[model samples]
Target: MSLSIGLVVHASRRGVFEEAVEPVSGVSLKWVTYGHERDIRPHVQSLVDGHALDGLLVGAVPYRACRDVLPRTLPVAVTRNSALDLALALGQAQARGWQAVPVSIDTFDHEVVCEVTESLHLDRTRVTCLPYADDQSVDEICAFHRRSLHDGDGYVITARTAVLRQSRGDLRVLNGSPTPSSIRSELRELLLRIRSERAGAAGFAAGVFCVSRHGCPGDPERSRMDLLHLLRATPELTDAWIENRGRRGVVVLGRRTLFERLSRDWLVAPVLDRAQESLNVPVSAGFGVGSSARTSVVLAERAAVRAESENRPCGYLMEDSGLVLGPIGPGGLGGPGGPGGRSAGQWTGPPTARPHREQGDRMRELARTVGLSPATLSRLAAIEHDVAGRAVTPSELADAMAVTDPSGRRLVRKLHAHGLVTSEGWAQTHRKGRPTGLYRLAIVAALTGSADGHALETV
Candidate 1:
C-alpha cells in the first residue's frame, strides 16, 4: 500500500517542499500550508483528524507550533536550516558586497556558525548567533537582529519567514532557509521509517493474560473464564485468536501491530485495568513477538511469569530480540515512573536487580556529590551501561529516560555541570536544523570512582 504523508509548511515555502518531493512510487503527499505559525495548529489538527497519515514532514516552525497535536505513533521529520544552507547564504551575502564577518544569524546553532566561519577564515568573534528555541517568539528573534544591527552588525540572516516580514525591508536580511535537497532528504527518510515500522508490525505476536492467584475470592477457573470473556469482548482484540492457557491464563494470538495499539507502543496497557475490575482480581499480561508462533508463545509465557511475579495488575512485553518492557498497567501511559518519572518501558537491557549494600553506598555517595537522588543516579548508570561508553544526543537520552525533550536537555546540562557527562561532539542525526549536541555519560565511571584523574570535558 502507498503510504500517505502529510507535509506541513509555511505558505511561502510550500513550493520548495512540493518541488523537492516531486513524484515517488508508493507515497502520496498531502500538503498543509499556513501563512503564519499560529495558523499551523488548526491546519495540522484538521489534517490529523481528517486523514489517516502514515507519516508527517514539517519544518521546525510548523513542528514547534503543532508538536503537541501530532500523534505519538506517527513518524515525523522536522526539517531545519543546515550548515550548507548557511554557507550558501554567506556566499550570496559576499556576492552582494557584504562582509561575512560582523553578521547576525538566527535559528542556526552556535557550533555550526563557528564551524562555517572558522573554515572560511572569517573572524569567529565577529559573528553573533542566536540559536533556535521552541519557546522563542519571532518578535524576540527580530529584536535580536535589531540590536545586532544597531550595534554595527553588517547583515542579518534568518531561517524564519516571519522574521523577514517583520524586518520591514529595513534590515539587510538574507534568507537561510533549508534547500529543496534537504527537504527531499528528510521526506525520503521519514518514508523509510514509516515503511520499516509497518513491516515490523506485521510480525507474529502471542500474548498471555494471567489472572493473579493470590488474594482472590472466586474460583480460579471462573476467574480465568472472566478474563477470557474480557479478552473476547475487547473491541481491539476482535481479530485475534484467543483461547485458554494453563489453569488461570488466557492466550491470544495476533499481529504485533494489534498488540502495539492496545499497549500504546508498549508504554501502557489499559485493558489490564478493565480485566482487574471485571474479574475482581489482579491481572497481569505478557506479550511477545518472535519469528514463529511457538517462539512467540514461549516468550509470552516467560514474560507472563515475570509479570505474575510482580504480584500485581501489571503487564510486560518481551521481544525475541531480547528487549523487555514492563509494569505497564493503570499508569496512564507514563510507564513505570508515571508522568515525568523514569520511563519504565525503556529497554536498558535485562533489569538490574537492586545493588548490594556496598554498591548502594557508593551510588548514594555519587548521588550526593552530584546533588541528585540515588535512584536517578542509578537510572543514569543503567543507561550509561547500556550504551557502553557511546555518545548520545539529548533526544536519545530523553527517550531512554522517558521524559520530554526539554527535560532531557535540562538533565544533560545538570549532569554536565556535575561532571557526570562530557560533551563529545555534534551529530547531524536529521537532515535539517542545527546538528544535535552529543555527550558521553561518565555516570558509571563516577560511581565506580574511575573519573578521579581526568579533567572535566566541555563541548
Candidate 2:
C-alpha cells in the first residue's frame, strides 16, 4: 500500500517540499499551512483528524514547537540546517564586501554554528553570534536584532519567517533553505521506520509463563485468575489470547511488536511487576518470535526452562538455534544477550567469553537497552579500552573492527542512532578532500561504587 504523508510547513516554505515530492512514487504528500510556527499543533491535529496520514514532515521551527505537544508514536521528520547553508548565506554577503558583521540565528544549535564557522575557516571573533532560546518572545527576538543593528552590526539572520516581517530594516531572513535532496532523504528515512513498525505488528510472538506461589499460598484457580488480571492491566496485551492456563504453564499469543514494547522493561513491566509484588509471588515469562505458532510455542517453553536454570525471577527467550536471550519479564530484571544467536546462519559478531561479574553484567544490560547483540557489546568494550578517554577516528575504528569502511560507517551510525556516540567535530589532514568525521563516545554518567564516585559509560 502507498503511504500518505502530511507536510506541516510555514506558508512561505511550502514550494520546496512540493517540488521534492514530485519525483517519488508510492507516497503522497498533503501540504498543510500554518500562519505561525508556534501555532502548529492545532493545524497538525486537524490534518490528522481529517486524513489518515502515515507520517508527517515538518519545518525545523514548527517541529521543535510541536514536538512535545504532539503524539510521539506518530512518525515525524524535521528538516535540518547544514554547514553549507551558513556558507551559502555568508558567501552572498562576502561578495558585497561585508566583513566582521554580527549574525543572529534562531532555532538552531549554537554548537553547530560554531562548528560550521570553524570548518569553513571563517574568522570566529569577527562575527558575534546571537541565538534565540525557545522561550524568547517575538518582541524580545526583534529587540535583540535592533540592538545588533544599533551597535553597528552589518547583518541579521533568522530562521523564523515571521521575524523578518517585523523588522523595518532590510533584514536577511536566513532561509536555511531546505534542499530537495535533504527533504527526500528525510522522507525516505521516515518511510523505513514506518515499514519496520508495520512488519513488527504483523509478525508473531509467544509468551510462556508460570506464577510462583511459594510463601503466600493461594488456590490454583485464583492464581490463574490473578495472572489473567495482571495481563489484562496492560493495553498492549489486549489483542493477546491465552492458549493454555493449566498446571503446566500459561501460554499467550500476541504481536511481536507488543513483545518488543513490553521487553523494554520501563514500558509495561511496572504493572505486572507491581501486581506480583502485591500478590507476594513472582512471575517468569519466556518470549519467542518465529514464523509459525508451533515454533514460537516451543521456543517460549525452552526460554522458560533457561530462565529457571539461571535462577531469574524474570523470563527468557530461546532462539530456534538453541541460543538463550534475556531475563525479560518483570521487576526491572530485563536485559539482552545471546552470543551464539545467529540470524539466517550468519555470524553477526566474533565469539567472545561471557562476563559473569558486575562490569560484564552492566555491559550486557546497556547492550540490551540499545538492541545490540552481546558480540557488538564486547567489541565496544575493547574499542573503548584501547582508546581510553579519547575519540576514535573513523579509519581507526574501521581498522580495529576489521570491517570495510562502509560497514564501519554503518556500525557508527547505529551507535549514533542510540545516542551512544556523536560526531565530535571534523578534522583536516591537509586542506585536500572533505574533512574526516571525528567521533567520540557519548558517556552517561551515573552514581556507581567506583573510587571516583562516578562511573561513565555508554548506553
Candidate 3:
C-alpha cells in the first residue's frame, strides 16, 4: 500500500522507479550523465521528447554535451540541497546581466509581478503566464512559451538540454580545448569582428563566455583558448584600464545551457577534458538561465551539485571515480578523455577529468537534496554572487536584491548575518577629485543556507 522510487537505472529500463522510493526518505536521482551523450542521451531524451516524470535530476558530463542537450529549458538548479537552493532565475534577467523572459504561472499578485518585471527591466509586453498541470507540466509549458517567444533574442531557458544544446559551436571552439594556439586563433577572429562593430568605444565592453569559458579555470591553455574565443567573438571585450563603478565588468560569453549546467554541474564534474595530457582540477563554473539573477543562480546551484558529485581528483567518471555515487545515473563513463573531451555527450555532458583539490577545495558544499526551484538558499547565493558583488557596502547588496535596503548597511550586515560576505575598509581613489570607500572580497565564497544565513560556511 505504499509507493517507491528508483533513483538510478542501468541498461535495464523496465523497472518501476516508483518502486525504489522510500517515503519520508532522501531525494531520488532522476537523470545522471557520465559526460557522454551516448552514456546518457536515451534516458534523458524522454525528458525533451515530451515524456513526463515527477522531477528532473539533470547532470552534464561536459560543456558541449550540455550545449547540445539544453537548447531550451531545464532551467537548471544550482544546488542539490533544497534548503540552500533558491530558484532565483525562473524568469528574472537583470540580476544575471543577460537578456531573458519570465514564464508566469498565474500565481503571483499582478502588482508584485509588475514590480519584479520593472525592476528586472524586462519588456512589459513580453511577460506571460500559464497554468501548470502538476509540476511535470512546468517543463512542457515553459518549452511551449519559449517557442512562442521565438528563439532569437537572449533567453534563460530551463532543462539542462536547453542550456547544453542552445549554443552554436562558434562559441565552443574558442574554449573547446583551450590551448595557446587555439586562443590565438579565436582572438584573431574575435578582434576582427569587434573592430567591425563598435569600432570606437573607449571603455570596456561586455564579454560573454560560451561553452569554452564555462569551466576553463583548471586548464589555463583552455582558459586562454576560451578567452581568445570570446575575444574573437566579441573583440571590444578588452581588459580595460579604467574600472567601471570601481569594478571590472567581464562578460564571459557563456551559453545558457552551459551556464545552466555550470550552475549545478561545475561542482559535480569540474574537469571536462585534458590539456596536454594532464588532468584538470577542481574548476569552478556558473549557470545563468531565464532573465533574472535568480534564474542564473538556479542554474548555478544545479551545476554546482553535478560538479561536486561527479568530479574526482584524477581524471574520472561519475561511476568510476570513487565519488560517493549518489543515486544519479549515467552508466560508467565511456572512457578517459584527451584534450577538451570532445563527444556528443561532452557536447551534451561528456565525462570529464580533474587534477586535485584539498578537502577544503570547494567554495560551496551545499547538502545534496532535491527540488529544481530551490526555495530560499538559491536566493542567498544569488545575493552574494550577483547582487552583493555589486555593492560598495552591505546596504547596496540589500537594495540590489530588491529586498529591504533601509540604511544601505545590508552588505556586510546581511552577509555577516547570513555568513556569506566579509568586508575590508573603504579606500580612496582619484576619479573626480573625491575620495571613496572601496570594499574587497573578504570571505564571499558561495555557500548554501536560509535567508537567516545559519547554514552557510566556507567550503
Candidate 4:
C-alpha cells in the first residue's frame, strides 16, 4: 500500500521537512494552515473523522501547534521522527551502559533507526535486519521472552511495547524511561556484562525492555577543538566525581577556576595554536588536571558542561573523564600555575622558569593507555577517509594536529618525538615568538597507519 502524509502547519511557517516521514517514492503530502488555535482542532478532527491520512506527522518546524490536537485513531508520527525512541534509547544506553544494537525491522525498511544508527556511528555488528514478525500481538511478545534469555544479544526491535509486554505471559516486565545522553554508557555496560558474564544476582531474568519519551542526543559531538585543546593543555587534571548510577554524561568533580587572572579568550590563543592554523573555525577550551588515581566520568561531565556553558558556543572540554583520575590533592588542581601553567614556548611568570614542565611525561601515559602516542593523538581531526575508507593524507594529518602542512616544523617535531620521523634542521631561537626551521619524518605512515595507533599532539 502506498503511504500518504498529511502536514498541519501554521500560516507563517514555510519549507517544512518531511524526508524523515515520507518515503523517497511511496509517500505523498497534503497540508492545512492554521492562523490560530480554533482553525487547527477542527481540521485535525475532520481529517481523523474522514480518514484522510494514513499517518499524521506533527511538529514545531512549521505548524507544530497541531501535534497535541491530532486524534489517536491513526498512527500519529511526531515531526521529529523517532526522536523519542532515539532519546530514550540513547539515555538508556548511557544509563545502563549498553552498546547500541542497530536492528532493522523486517519487510518494511525501518529507515528512522537506520539513519540514526549511521549518524551515531554505531558498530555495524550491533545493527542488523531481522525478518518482520506480523504477529505483533500478545503472542509475539511471548515469543520475544524466549528469545531474550537464550542469547542476550543487543537487539533493536521496532514493535509496540505495550503489546510486547502483554505477550510475555510469565516473564517480569521491567519498565523505565532512559535519558538521551546515557544511551552510549548503558550500551557499554551491557556489552561488558555480556563479554565477562558479569550478570547480577537477579538471576533467571528473561530480558530487559526500555521505552524512552525523549530521543538520543544526535551525536557524541565536541564542538570546535576547544575541548581537545583544554584536555591537552591541562596535563595535571584527573577524574573525580562519578555518575554511573543510571545516566551517562553527568559527573561532578572538584572545581578548578581556569582563569583566576588570565581570562578564557587570552588562554585559547596558545592552547589551540596549531589547530587554529589549520581549521578556519577558531576554538576555545575548559579543562583542569588532577591525580590519576580514580578514573571517574564526573570530571569529563563537568568539563564538558563548563565548556558548553561558560566557554563560547564551539567551546568544549576533554578532561580526564574516565581515562585518567586520582585522589583529593593539595591545590584543588587549578590555581596560579596549576596544570596548564607553561604557556607553550613563551613563558609568563613572577620568576623566570623553563618551558619544559615535564607535562609531556604525564601525557605520555594517557596516550599509551589509549594505545597510541601523544603526538598521534594530538593530530586528531575529522579528515576525509580514503576511497575505501582508510588512510590519512599528510594534509589530513596536519589538520588533525592543527598544523598547516604535514612536513611542517611542528609536525616534524611531533613525528620525531614519536620515532616516526627524523629531523635535519633543529634550530633554536632566543626570540619569544614561534619556532622555525622545517624538517620531515624518517618514513611517512600517513596513509597506512591506524588513527588509534598514533597519539594526538598537544592541541
Candidate 5:
C-alpha cells in the first residue's frame, strides 16, 4: 500500500522539500506551508484532521509550534540542518568573497559550528554561535544578529525564515536551511519507520482463553469446549479462528490489528468480562503479537498464565517487543484502571486482603531478598514462566527481556550468584559462533518459597 505523508515547512523552504520528495515512489505528500511559525499550528491541525497520514516530516520550528496538536501515535521525523549544510553555506559565502571569520550563526548547535570552523582552518574564537532553543523567538534571534553586526561581525547566518526576511535589508544574512540531501535522508528514515509499524500491525496475533479451575469445577475438556463456544459466539472475534488449545484452554488466531481494535489498543477487552458473566465462571484471556504463529501462540500462552495468576476474570496482552499490558477487568474502558494506568506488577484487587495482593507482597519480598526491584523481578518471573523450566542462553534471555546482550550476561551472572539460576551445558545454536552457555531460571520456585530451601528465604 502507498503511504500518505504530511510535510510541514516554511514557505521559503517548501520548494526544496517538494523537489526532494518528487522522485520518491509509493508516497503521497500533504503539504502544510506557513510564512511564520505562529501560523503553523492551525494548518498542521487541518492537515492531520483531513488526512490519514502514515507519517509526518517537519522542521524544528514547526515541530515545536505544533507538537501539542500532533497525535501521540503518529510517526514523526524532525528534520534539522546537519554539519554538511553548515559547511556548504560557509563554502558559498567564501566563494562570494565574504570573510568566514567574525561571523555570527544561529539555530545550529555549537559543536556543529566548531567542527566546520576547525575543518576550514578558520579562527574559532572569532565566530559567535547561538544554539537553538525550544522557547526562542524570531525577534530574539533578529536582535542577536543586530548586536553581532553592530559589534563589527562580517555577516550573520540564520536557519529561521522570519529572522532572515526581517533583517535582509540591513544585515548580510545567509540562509542556513538544511540542504535537499539532509531533508531526503530524514524523509527516508521516517518512511522506513512507518513501514515497520505497518508490518507489525499486520503481524500474527494469538489469543488464549483458559477457564479458572476454582471458578468452574467440572471436567477439564468440557470447560475447554465451553470456552471455545463462547469465543466463537463473540461478534468481535468473528474473523478469528477459534479452536481448543489444551485441557482447559481455547485459542484464537487472527491479525494483530484485529486484537488491537477489539481490546481497544490493548487497554481493555470487554469481551472477556462478557464471557465470564455468560459462562458463570472466571475466564482469563491472553493476547500476543509476534512475527510467526508459534512465537505468537507461545507468548499468548505465557500471557494467559499471567492472567491466571491474578485468579480472576481478567486479560493481558504481550508483544514480542517486550511490552506487557494488563489485568484488564471491570471499569477498564476509558477509566483510570486501564492498561497503562497501573504498574505492570501491581494487583488490581482492593487495598485490603486479597490473594493477588498477598502474592504481590510475597514477590516484592523475594525481590528485596535478591537485591532487585519488584518490577525487574516481575519481568524475570515472566521469563521463567515462559521458558517452563527449560534451560536458556543469555542471548535468548536478552531477547525476552528486551535488553542488550551485555546487560543480559550481567543479569545471568547476578542470578547465578543469588542461586536463582544454575548453569547447564553449552549449545551451538549458530554454526559460526562458539557454543553459548545455558542457565535454567528458578525465579518461580523462589517466589513460591521452594528454591532449594536455603539460598532464598521463604517470603
Candidate 6:
C-alpha cells in the first residue's frame, strides 16, 4: 500500500504551498488547514483517523506550538523558523537593498539575529528580533509587525500567517516555511523505520529442551536447580521452565530478535557452555523453529532426544520446514572432567537408570499427577505446540484452543495448581471495562521416566 501522508498547513498559506509542490509520487496526501499552528493538532489527528495516514507533514508550525499535542507514535515532521530560514529572510532584505533599513523578524532570538547580521556583514543595531513565548497570541504578533512597519523600516519577516495577511506595499512578509527537501528527508527516514519494525515482527521461535543429568554425578539436584536458574537469568530466553517433576531440562521461548542471535551462534552455544561449566554437567539441548508453538516444541524434543542418544554436548535444530540439522557440538568444554573426558561436554550415561515409559503411560501418569482428565490434558498438549511461548487472555486461549472462554480460564487455573503456569499481571484494554488477566506458562507436564510430555501453561 502507498504510504498515506497528512499535511497540516496554515489556511492562508495553503494556496502558495499547492502552487510550489505537486503531488508526491509514492504517497497519498491528505491536507488539513488550520487558522493557527497551535490548533493544527486536532485537524492533523482527524486526518490521521480519516485517511489512516502513515506519516504527517506539518507546515509552518513552530516546534513549540505542536510539540505537546502531536502524536508521539506517528512519524511527524514540523516546519520551524530555523536558522536557514532566517538566512532566507535576510537574503530577501539584502536583495531589496534594505541593508541600511531596520529589519523586523518574528519568532527569532536576538542572538540569532546578531549571527545573521554578522554573516551578512550588516550592523546588528539595524536588526530587531521578536521572540514570542508559547503564551503569545497571533494578534500580539501582528501588532508587533504593525508597530515595526510604522516606527522603523518596512522590511519585515514572520512565521505567523496573521502577519502575512496584514502585509501590503513596502511592508513585505516572508513566511518561514520548511523546504521541500527537508520534508522529503523526514518522510524517507520514517519509511525506513517502518520497514525495519515490520521485518522484526514477522515471526518468533520457541524451543523445548530435554536435558539429561547423567554427566553430573556430584550433587545432581543442585546442578539441576542451577540449570533452571541459568535458563531463567539469560536475557535471550523470553520464557523458561523445567516442565517436569525431575527437572529433565528447560523449555525456552524466544522472540524473533533472540532467534536471530541463535542463528548467529551467539545465544544458544554460549548458554549451553555456561550451563555445562556451572552445573558440572554435559548438556544436550534440542532447538526447534516452526510457525506454531506445538510444531516447534515437538521438533525441539526430537532434537534433544537425538543429542541424548549421541551422548554429546551438542544441539540439534529442527527448522519449521521439517529439516533436521546437526549433532552440532559446543565450541569449548571446560567443565569438571577437562576437554577430553566425558564430563567435559559429553554425557557418559544416565546416572540412575530407570525403565522407559511409553507415550500413553506418560500421558496417563501426567494426567493423574495434575488431577485433570486425560482428554483435557491431551487437548492442552495439542494447544501447547501452537503457543509459540506467548501469554494469552482467556478469550485468546479459547479461540486458539477451540474451547469456551470460561473453560480456558478453568483449564489454566488447574494447570497453575499443578505448578505449570503462573499469574503475571492484568492488562487493561479500555478505561471503562474490567481488566483482562495475563498468565504466563511456567512448565510442561512430563511423566516419570519418559521424555514425552504435554503442554502445561503459557503467557
Highest TM-score scorer:
5
1-459 per-residue lDDT for model 4 (tens digits): 445556565554323233223223444556666665457777776666665665554432222334455543334432222334554555555566655553323211223334445567666445543322333343454455446433554543333334334533544232222222222232233233222221211111110001111222222122222333333344322332322222212222333332211222112223233222232222322333333213223333344344434222122223331221111111112233654343344323211111111223334432332224334543331222222233333444465556676233234333333344333332345375222332333222332244332222232
Question: For all the candidates, what are their Cα RMSDs to the real structure?
Answer: 12.7, 12.2, 24.6, 25.8, 14.3, 23.7
Clashes per model (N, Cα, C within 3 A): 1, 0, 115, 66, 0, 10
Per-residue lDDT tens digits for candidate 5, residues 1-459, read 788999998887889998888778899889998986778999999998998988889887788789888886677777776778889888878988998877889987654675577778888767888877777888898888777768655888888888888888888888989988888887887787667657877889999988887868677678678778878887878899888887889999999888867776555666665555456656788888877888899989988988899887677766665556566553232224553244455333322223233454555444433435555767887777777779998889999989987667667755664567887866889997445668899887776676432121111
- CA lDDT for candidate 3: 0.31
Q: 2 or 6, which is superior by TM-score? A: 2
Q: Tell me the lDDT of model 4 at 307.
A: 43
TM per candidate comes to 0.57, 0.54, 0.20, 0.20, 0.63, 0.43
Look at candidate 1 and give me any clashing residue pairs. 80-433
lDDT of each residue in 346-458, candidate 3, tens digit only: 32232321111111122212211111112233444444554444435434544654656432332333233222444354434545432222343323243312232322211
The CA lDDT at 73 in model 3 is 24
User: Global lDDT of each model?
Assistant: 0.74, 0.60, 0.31, 0.35, 0.74, 0.57
Q: Could you give candidate 2's per-residue lDDT for residues 1-459 as a string of tens digits?
A: 899888887777778777777787888777778887656887777777888888788765676566665553566665655445666766766776766356665544444466567767766565544443446677788777766666655676565677767763556545545567777776777777677656645778788776654433676556766767667666777878874557636788887767767655212244335545555455666777666677888778776666556443466654442234454435332223432222353212111111112333454444433434445655665466567647776667789879876556556655654446666876775677545567875532211233222232221
Residue-level lDDT for 74 in candidate 3: 28
By lDDT: ranked, best first: 1, 5, 2, 6, 4, 3
Q: Residue 130 of model 1: what lDDT?
A: 86
Better of 4 and 6 by TM-score: 6
Clashing pairs in 5: none
> Model 1, 1-459: lDDT tens per residue?
788999988888888877888855688888898886779999999999999998888876787778789875567776766668899999999999987778889987654676678668787667888877767898899899888778655888899898988885778888899988877876777677566545656878999998888966888888899889889999889999999998999999999889877776666667776665456766788888877889899989988988889876677666654445555554342436554233555422112211222344455445433435455666777778778879999889999989987668767755764567887877988896456789999886665566432211110
For candidate 6, give the lDDT of residue 276.
65
For model 4, the superposed segments whose C-alpha errors exceed 4 Å read 1-84, 102-108, 129-135, 141-149, 153-159, 167-459
lDDT (Cα, 0-100) at 303 in candidate 6: 71
